[model samples]
Target: MVSFQQESDGDPASKPWYELGSAKHQGTEVTMARILQEQYPSHSLVLAHDVLYTTYTRFSILSMPGVEVELVSKPDLVVNNSFKALPRSAFVGTPGGDNVSAELVPSVEYGGFKLTWKDRHFLLYIVHFARGLSTNTQFFLLHDGPEEPSHQLLLAAGSYQNELHDEIWQFVDGFWQKSSGLWKDIQSANWDDIILESDFKAAVKKDVYGFFESRDMYKRFKIPWRRGIIMHGPPGNGKTISVKAIMKDCSVMGYTPLYVKTFKNFRGDEYAIQAIFDKARDTAPSVIVLEDLDSHITEQNRSYFLNQIDGIGGNNGILVLGTTNHFERLDPALSTRPSRFDRKFLFDDPDRPSRRLYVKYWQDQLAGSEDISFPEALAEEIADSTGKFSFAYLKEVFVSSLVSLLKEREEGHDVSFARCVREEIATLRKQLDKPQGPEVARNSQLAMVH
Candidate 1:
């Protein structure tokens, strides 16, 4: 394979290719940038920047605003312009470096399309707008070198399939609706320092007050009376539990809880979400729970999601309670919106007060037994033991430890709180030794202490 790039010595703009009628393209290289700018106006195009001198000449013509065409290929063949007009040698130092077993192969077809390969051939895809446009383009080289590209092809196909699914979603983002049946009677309480953290309790009070007060002020302006709260944390740290507790608190303060998910179990059935939001708007005093928010709406769906949230035909009286493990990955525009999430709370593991409360709660649940009694020092130990254990893990710790103790007792051995604590510590010690799995360790620690 030989490659050639036309270059003028004096000026680039004076080149023959730059002339409107001099160098004409035989077939349209698909004006993707123009298509994206005209069609998907919301997204911007990002070009792949891996191609070199020879490759740039062909793709550069297609580059435009909000559109970037990049050639994802290897630089295996070093062109020596000796005899051939397109002076590039393919056989002798092929793109196949020491990392790959396959040799470099080059071919030309499809209106001057060149295929240069090291591990496998990477066909150039002209990307118009870069907002998660899925295509049947395979990514061969993952960790520097490449092996067989069968897996890469599979991944590309899967990605394209997902892209097709996303295209269907753009249509559904226009309207606003919600279901009234989504509301559930939540049980909330003014828990002691043990059951609830100070910051959490403080946020609850602030949001509850803000909701009513803000409504009175916004009524004059005709803006819907609504607010949003974003709760983010590691998994099993009791995000769901905190939501349940928060909903209960909201109900006690004379508010209803409306729960919503982005998608239903069945495909293309998002009417439930719309219906729920509609009810929340009509219900006046309602708190909406949108669990796993990141999963439901991501950066890819930002424009559509924003349309539903604050775009035309939006909802009011809806306090969106969203939970996510990865808050940083959320769309920047969504986070920046004051109307979207006015209050953002991050749920870390239970501190000393929370740990003590969990222990007390578990002890009360197992109160009939004379063998286990809650100790103050044991509370501190459990608190220390649960470095990042969530309330969910704390409950599991109690259950696992109690079950282990009951088994030992049935086997004719005396089991006490001391034994349970020891068993819990031993479990943590074992987890600390493992090479992977922190969630498992955290859960183990929670079971041991709580």
Candidate 2:
């Protein structure tokens, strides 16, 4: 029988069970290991416990090949018949409209089940121990054969998790989680939707496409195959949209896109950095998107981040694409370093031609709408008048003007859509004259795109 060994000088069996206060019991309760031994005397037990920085889950382990797991009809004597219900929300997009659906997923919180692998039967119990403020989950596998084979089985289960093709892996809260919603959200982002200089757009695409396609070229030259590119510019430019378009294309090209939301977690930032690179190495030929890279890297973690990017362990076949609104905030080691972030693309304010193209994009959108009139010549006029305005501000001018026009139409007042747009642009230009802080600017940018 497997037992929980106490580190201190105390009898483990004499200790009270953590959940004893939940019920009224006269006698002292025994451990689950003792109960398992008394209930199944013929089976040998193998215990797998969670360690620091490592965790094992039933779904992840059971997802291994040739392992068939089924819920037992009857609950074990030691474990209770309780299940945890978690709420899951999903967006269903269709041709008609978008609908959000919510459902509860009932999972076994404390349960025992049977599994068959290679014609051998085994009993498994999932146990959760409440320690002060946190919970630790452990697995108990009972089999008839020797302990070595059972240990090997557990090792195999812990070593591998099925690769996800339909979902993108995101590192958040110190864990690599599957984000199917992000993958779905990027599907609509295409290169054609981006408004930028033709040569600049082609350069961005060629750099990304060339790195992934030229592995043999790097081998012949005897150079490292990894590359890092940074997109730096003012807020509300095309940095984010460009990144999304590239991510969508990379997904189509069969390279996994791993997005890092943050590097701060319960564990130190250094640990998070290590875990991030480890996952990236495991999924080589992958693209890592670090949006707001300036905020993610600080003086404390800059050295460690650089080491991981071009460290001795080698970052082969991994492309690191980072975006930042404030390029000056980045350290020289990161921005100026050759191998760390080899190339930098400046996404400054859109030129007159790009702004005109953006206005034309809106014209095409409103071509079918009879309520709004956006003529061909107004595109050039709007672009000319909207000087020094970021894409976010331009978008706000359009959206706010449309809203004002709708209100005027509802009040039985005839208003010209083009005049409303020109007035809104003038009003926004006044706001731009006043000195704005970073937080205010960030909020304005987020409102336009998100």
- Runs of candidate 1 with Cα error greater than 4 angstroms are 1-194, 220-224, 249-254, 264-276, 363-368, 428-450
Quote model 1's TM-score: 0.49
Error of 2 at 109 (Å): 3.7
Pick by TM-score: which candidate is best? 2
Q: What's the lDDT for residue 119 in model 2?
A: 71
Candidate 2 lDDT, 1-450, residue by residue in tens: 333222253322112333542555532213566666665677788877655343325234556788887754342324435343323453555587855354333334455666777677777766565554565666778786667767777877766543564677888878777777788888888888777777778888898999999999999999999999999888887888888888888888887788999998888899888988887788888899999999999889988888899855778989999999998898888888778888888887666676887888788878899888787778778988887788888889889998999999999999999999989998998988834323222211112110
Q: Give lDDT for model 1.
A: 0.50
By TM-score, how accurate is candidate 2?
A: 0.77
- Once superposed on the true structure, which residue ranges of model 2 sit more than 4 Å away at CA? 1-38, 41-58, 61-107, 116-121, 131-134, 143-162, 434-450
- How far is 325's C-alpha from truth in model 2 (Å)? 0.9
lDDT of candidate 1 at residue 379, scale 0 to 100: 66
List the candidates' TM-scores in order. 0.49, 0.77
Per residue, candidate 1 scores C-alpha lDDT tens digits across 1-450 of 223232234222222212322344431223332432343243333333222211112222222222223332222211223232322332344365533323433322111112233333322332211112321211112211232342443344334432211111111232222222222323322344235555665665576557765776778888777777777766766567667666656655666665564544332334545555565666556776778887777444456556666725656566777888887777766555677777676665666566776777766776787777766677677766775566666766777787888888889987786678667756754654533224332331222100
Residue 176 accuracy (lDDT) in model 1: 28
- Candidate 1 worst ten-residue window by lDDT: 163-172
